[model samples]
Target: MHLNRFDDLAADVSRGLARRTSRRSFTSKVGVWLFGAVAAPLLLPVARGRAEDRYAGEEGDPRSCDYWRYCATNGYLCECCGGSANECPPGTTMSALSWIGTCRNPADGKNYLISYNDCCGTAQCNRCSCSRHESETPVYRAGTANDIHWCSANESTAINCTVAVVLGAAEDEV
Candidate 1:
């Protein structure tokens, strides 16, 4: 019986593979692959928490720039740049000075004081870029103006992203 060139090549490859690897080694490799496939899903929740879970009592997505705390935010969102809305990303520093904004919470019908702090020491995050001009003051008013570079005061002038942190509930204006 004559075998085709394809069959002969396949037989030669299989013989070479069998000569190099034992049955036990092949079984162990297959076992490892199966174990990895089975274990991947179990590790997902530990890696990334659900978005709604992260913002338990908040009204909107923390990753979005339209969140209630970001009424006057004017940069990339930290939540979308590997950090939470109130935290800076790894390797970045939060600005010492922050522009304050009073945003009303749609869920509670009360105003909250939001501190717009910029994360510096890295290039711009370029993700989830958002700018809301609501109640922004003129550029001359540095404390309330969102146009100023908050990262300029940091050791690194590179603006990475912005975090909208809730300082407290705003007092009612008399």
Candidate 2:
């Protein structure tokens, strides 16, 4: 008898819900929620913009994202913020810790170890923003990943720009 009573109550609740909303309305609401869940995260990154066009051979500009040294970089270029590719801006200091990348210099045709260091101090330099995902690694392998804030170890964690310093040419593996 108790089971029968619970079933009748459940049927009444379902009938009321069905009367209150149409199938089209329910599906449209679900679709909107699903779209928001999927697409919202893509817009959350701090940087937004298309990467600069890649140049052929050794002619690419350092200020652009397609430059040889920035093969795995994912931040604003220091070259656009009153600094060269290998140096931090005037006031900001380069973080000691850096994410590493191996990039082939178009001019030399040799792979070099590029240390992507972040300049910390002021707010982010919103200029020349670009992200090159070449040889990107998972976040678990933090040393090889470029999509993280590398300025966290400094006095001021505010990242201004990133400089890709060439450590040395990478030796060929046997």
Candidate 3:
């Protein structure tokens, strides 16, 4: 009796699976394909517009750390040193690690979160030490603090943080 009950259960499950597989009719498949084809083109422009909106910035002197892009900047400006706003100096390397800061872009009137990674393997760029702190804390709170030297993790010697370069930007969380 138990064996017969098990066989009946197996047959019921097999029938259920067969029904599920057969439910996707030809009309349903065509409807789904048609919906995707019609919606993709209409959605693409909106997606592109949102991406463009996140990258808005104001025209300002890059040499000054208080430039529109450097709203929450915490270290020396790379432009003041031998490097541009987004690049490290000739000999120095841009560190993979970085700190996050939220800077308001005057162009779009939106706050953008930027990654400020230090350029390692060079002397500290002592020129423009712009300590514009937004969410930054003291070195005791190393996770959020940009004042602490970040190059020590990448460089062998105890080199301090040199130029701070804008690695990337995105929309602010809040």
In TM-score terms, which candidate is top? 1
The digit string of per-residue lDDT tens for model 3 on 24-126 reads: 3233233323333544454335323433222235444565443556655566677667877777877787777777766666666666666777777767667
Which run of 10 residues does model 1 get worst, by summed lDDT? 16-25
For all the candidates, what are their Cα RMSDs to the real structure? 17.8, 15.7, 21.4
Worst 10 residues of 3 by lDDT: 16-25
Collision pairs in model 3: none
Evaluated at residue 165, the lDDT of candidate 3 is 40
Per-structure clash totals for the candidates: 0, 0, 0
Give the TM-score comparing model 1 with the true structure, all chains together: 0.67
What do the candidate models score in CA lDDT, each in turn?
Answer: 0.71, 0.70, 0.55
lDDT by residue for model 2 (45-126), tens: 3112433334334445677565678788877889899888889999999899999888888676888888999999998898
> Candidate 2: how large is its RMSD?
15.7
Q: Give the higher-TM-score candidate: 1 or 3.
A: 1
Stretches of candidate 1 off by over 4 Å are: 1-53
Top-scoring candidate (lDDT):
1
Q: What is the overall TM-score of model 3 with all chains considered together?
A: 0.56
